[model samples]
Target: MEAVRATEIMVAAGARELRDGQTVVVGLGLPQVACVLARRTHAPALSLLLEIGVTNMNPVDTPIGLADSRIFYRATCWSGFLDILGMNLHRGVVDVGFLGALEIDRFGNINTTLLKEDSGKLRYFNGSAGGNDVASLAGRVIVIMRHEKRKLPTAVAHLTSPGFPGGRSRKDLGLRGEGPQRIITDKAVLGFDRGTHQATLLSLHPGVELQDVIENTGFRMETPKTVPATPLPTPEELRLLREEIDPKNVYLG
Candidate 1:
């Protein structure tokens, strides 16, 4: 069930922006899965720019990270890691940015730096690397995370990457392409309102109730009068997801 939910979230996020012949910067975890799925199922012509400097990678299995050799094996072009960060990312040529986070706020701010409590007990995970650049330069940003009260909080302890930090408002922030365009979770797919920057429930998966989504969110949400149900993965999509992208069962059962 978790596998299905994770895949659902990945695909939902992928479907929001992936287009043929576009270049995308993909982070690790769900972002990797989503990129692979998009290349195989939806946008075969899409070019992937991996953080480790492989571009247009088409791999049969999901890689652990940019360092995975499979990415180099299928890449159309390869460069130094610093080249991808300093030249490609900073130049604002990436069409889409896919990222995974431990916590995300209603304002589209992400936190993958630390896990802490009210008492300041900190348990650190992987520290921020190129996430700041990915959030800053990509044309569009899509966040993929699990839907839970603790994970989707009203605020994060540390603002590792700013979401609309300097802009006068959310709309102004989006003008620079810094704020998140969409958020996909286990239970539902959500997006921030263009005008208000408040998280809004966009679609729910089959058998998932609106209340289920509401309960997991940490802030007040704008739910539509008629929320749509998420389309189930087709047999071909399922087969590809299970057999090609995640054959080792890391993301699926």
Candidate 2:
């Protein structure tokens, strides 16, 4: 069996947030791994809606990206981005969405566009490929990313996807569903404050300290007086994550 790793632990943590029978709109990378693990273990009835137009695919292998051929294997329906993003997402049918951002602010607004500049020109990372739609329209959104001061900024240099912008309701922005609900990181799981929508420390990862979370965060966050440790991955969950879901540790790394 593969040794439990930080990335694997993060994936397992993210998977626990999903419920069976929910329609999950998934992005590439760690989000994909988490959704796949959930489907195989706890959320078997979970329907995965991909950004690149595949839905409910019983995928066999870990896909590197949304366009990977493996995503279409045993897929239930075949469509284009227009039908998936415009039809289903626009209709607000995606119950949960898994996303990542280069930088995320305390309010959950994401920035994936540009991190730095080279040669006096802006250096762009992957642009918003349904991130805006997913964050805006998914019934709930979960962001998975490495926990670090640089990645968790007080404010993103630019906002690529809106998340309770200025603590306004989704309806106020003409969006259909609730905005970001959770952020799963390497060291902690952060949830939004119910009233203010600011990031709040929900739980610390095993062996991680509240001070670690605060020191790593670039901006001020709501810290609980006593943060319970996040539940560790069970033996069975770790087994399936290593053997069935990602034997090669493609995304577990």
Candidate 3:
């Protein structure tokens, strides 16, 4: 069930966007799964700009990381780590960015920094790489995370990377383009209300009810009278997702 949820979220995240020839900046974890699935299933020609600087890589198997050999073997160019942020991302060339967050607020601020403040205990989880640049530069940002009260918060404790940054801060900073367009999770799909930047329930998964989604969220959500169930994965999509993208089932675990 957890594997199904992870695959569903990855496929939903991949299905959101990526025109046939657009370039996307992909992060690790679920973002990697979605990017590969996008290339294989929907946008075959989509160019993937990996965090470690592999541009336009099409891999038979999902690479473990940016340094994976498949990246260099399939890339148009392999750039240095610094070049990805200082040059490519800063240039606004990436059409989309797929990211994972520990906690995401209603305004779309993401926190991957730390689970707890004084925890040298959680050091393994406290890394923020390319998230700031991806959120800032990508034309569109898609966040994939587990839907739980702990992960979906009214406000993030720390803003490792700002997406909406709240209306006031965004307006004051004169930021352009809508940030963090959508968040795809295990139980439902959510989007930021255009007027308030507050999270709005867009739809729910099959067998998932409104109460199930609402119970997981930390705040009151404005839901439509009718929320549709997400479409089930096609046979081919499911097979490809399980075999090629996540053979080891890392995401499922």
Q: Best lDDT goes to which candidate?
A: 2
lDDT of each: 0.75, 0.87, 0.75
**Candidate 2 local lDDT, 121-227, one digit each (tens):** 77789889899889888899999999999899888878999998887777787877788989999999999987888999999888887888899999799888888
Q: What's model 2's overall lDDT?
A: 0.87
Report clash pairs, candidate 3: none
TM-score of each: 0.90, 0.95, 0.88
Error of 3 at 30 (Å): 0.9
For model 3, residues 1-253, the per-residue Cα lDDT tens digits are: 2235545554645565567777788887777777777778778888787777677776666556766785566667878766766566777677788889999988888998877546535534655788877887777788988889979888887788787775444545565445788888888888878788778988788878899899999877889998977666666777777777677776644
Clash tally for model 3: 0
What TM-score would you give candidate 1 relative to the actual structure? 0.90
Q: Candidate 1 residues 31-67, lDDT tens each?
A: 7777777778778888788777788877765666678
- How many clashes show up in model 1? 0
* Regions of candidate 2 where Cα sits further than 4 Å from its true position: 1-3, 117-121
Best of the two (1, 2) by TM-score:
2
